[model samples]
Target: MSDLTFVLAGPVRHGVRLHAQALGRRTRGAPLVNIEDGALPPGPVHLHFTDRIFGRDALDAAERLAALVGTRPLSVTLHDLPQPSDGASFERRRQGYARVVAGARGVQVSSEHERGLLEQVWGACGDGAMPPVAVVPLPVDRPTRWGPPAGAQGSTDGAVVVLGFVYPGKGHAETLAAMASLSTGVPLVAVGAPSDGHEDLLTELEDEAAAQGRSFVCTGYVTDEDLERWTARAAIPVSAHTHISASGSINRWISAARRPIVTPGAYVGELHRRAPWAVTVAADLPAAIGAALHDPTSTWIREAEWDGAALPDTGTAAAMQLAAIEAIGLA
Candidate 1:
């Protein structure tokens, strides 16, 4: 049995909380504790850290985490880590995340790309020895039902689906522009709601889609079943994020057996390297989408690969986390 306690903080639907729940299920004997609830069990605690989940801003989140952990040994899996792409808030977030990393007994990240981002922002530890950092690639869930719906083969009648919360730089505007450029006429669908403070962006998107004589729909906050259906029906699934350390959306598409057209980036390249069959990387997203629309089957993962041994799941992630915690002497 493990001695670690997994701390759950954030909205129920948030990615961090969802990941925590998935990890907790696979991590035997580790109690999942709600951080909102007053006391916690005795022992080292593991938190899936992200500034948005913990507080209003980066500095506030760091301070709140320090207070919550108090004297307990803390190991964190950092998410939404600071990078030069953050523009105006880069330094502030870098400062706050540095403090968080400095205080942790050990740290975990989802990908090598993210680890590089952290090292760039935080630099080497005081003595020049690198902090204990573990790289656990984010797990891809196996869908309850794999592959697209029957008769979906080579069909361009379906909408172009973009999964996850809508926000600035999340690929929505780029996707819209691409669709407009292609004049594909295929509706652009956001399979999730807008992120907080970005609701206006949806209105703008709808107006743009209308002006371009293309259809657009925001299926805000869909159920898992609905998401699967959307993926199954999508003519083209895209992950064109301009600023990403790690992308859950790409993994989510993989889980659904849909190989999305992903924009090239360090993290995307890493994922592509690991599972070349999972995504189609393209620099010109519009051309990629147009090609995908012409041959929809190009976006569907073959049955053999979906059932193959190459795919990693939450269980694999949990085992890696357990091993990492033990190596850090926290388990």
Candidate 2:
């Protein structure tokens, strides 16, 4: 049996590394490759890649890394695809995929939406039209139960927390207004840099925080440990995202703490159905946030924290898929 070698191409911080180690232990015996140094292995059965950025450096890196792999069965596991943006880097990325398919057997995308993006890639590559997508859910590893921290726990003065990267499409500005309307002294945390927002936007958020004297922790780029700490401590972990497909970390925190979330218009209904207590509202509208926050206990937030099970280790998903690949007796 040939062992699988998984690659982590870019700046995958400590938590991801720890998860990879855990996945490696769970993988029976396959070696998981950490390509943080941008080095390629000799040759593995398949080449797996994960990415979430659309920045030039990230796109260029993906192109170069794809070259190093030199045509193995490729999987471009993208967390989010740029659909609303003007910069069609997706087309450029498709060209890279074309280079892969000229020698590689096939390519796999992470989600159905992402699969659509891949089809666009193929079309841009002048590969004619592609077919339907085959999507597999990432994972639902969230703990069934959760409690407060070891040190202390208490209710907020009515602060609603936003717990992911701060991108323009993630509904930062919209949430700011909604929070402003709410009576609670709620604050928004712009965790990571999600998308391209005008510089003035950050300045606006600063002004809002300054005006209210509320606590809005704009920790630009936090370590994984800090990410977990912040997510776990918040009273309400809201995600007013409108750009991305799915938020694994946001979902994980919800599952962990049954935390109330005011999701964007896209995910509002689905989130309400799955976890009714977790509020999902239109992130573009401040009224939505105000409405959800109004009923603090409206089947939205109960009691939970992100218990480290937001996204299943894609390494595990890869292992499962790789086994199926082997079952067919093909390399």
Candidate 3:
């Protein structure tokens, strides 16, 4: 049996799978094992990925997971919690997360903003005692060697680029709208596949692009290699999220591409504190892209900072997880 087990109660998707793979590589000789919907191997500590509880029965599912992992030294991490559309929904989600907190030895959050939000919800739910909490930023792997993807390189030709999975708040429509009004007639390419049940949105966006006379292309989905190549081709990249809590996509873009990004005011504020090269824009998206194009120096500075700095190591991340788990009174 391993000393630690990573429990993936749900499907191993992007962030969850990436973190697990990194941990496996780092925790050699420590006997780290990963399992899904099966008995957890005997271990000193177990960490569960609880970032995908957005269903209608989210609270019930959490309770069931807690019961199944009974009496084990378990910790939980939320990649991104569902944004509550109203007060009632907020309360519902809070109660669900509270149940998870009550069961786990501790909880790990990615950012200070996320920690604050968790605390606020814990307070509102009147959960007796908030569990031990730690702020551990997601591990960013080192940049790989850059190579232009076949045919993808120079395919976009100075067009605006938006990368990552297509979801509701990703601001795809908003980006097309902004493109429609640009005087310079810049092309736009939105790369990546839509989430389940969101395929229609892509069709709508295509029709809207035609109606508005904006040159738009949807690459559906591309490999990581292609993503990097496409990103390098972008004249200016846009993060245009309507509401962003924690974005792995943004982190990868900034760290790898080292290019200037045009994002909303909130990201601009957040990144400026850490990465000053990020530019913020108002409601007018075209103007912001134009501004970013004019100041490529800022992007260069941002990129230079990343090139000089090293990303957090997986071994360090494993050490931090172990410390947090042990702090909760687990052996």
TM-score against truth, every candidate: 0.95, 0.72, 0.82
Summarize candidate 2's per-residue lDDT along 24-97 as a digit string, tens digits: 45555566675555555554534444333323643564566566666454433333444435265655555544
lDDT of each: 0.85, 0.52, 0.62
Clash pairs, model 1 backbone: none
Q: Which stretches of candidate 1 lie over 4 Å from their true place?
A: 124-130, 143-146, 151-154, 307-309
Which tens-of-lDDT digit does each residue in 135-199 have in candidate 1? 98788877666666676634666688899999998998888888877654578899899999999
Error of 2 at 38 (Å): 6.7
When 1 and 2 are scored with lDDT, the better candidate is: 1
Ranking of candidates on TM-score, top first: 1, 3, 2
Question: Residue 323: error of model 3 in Å?
Answer: 3.0
Cα RMSD (angstroms) for every candidate in the order listed: 1.9, 4.9, 3.7
For all candidates, what are the clash counts? 0, 8, 0
Which candidate number maximizes TM-score? Answer: 1
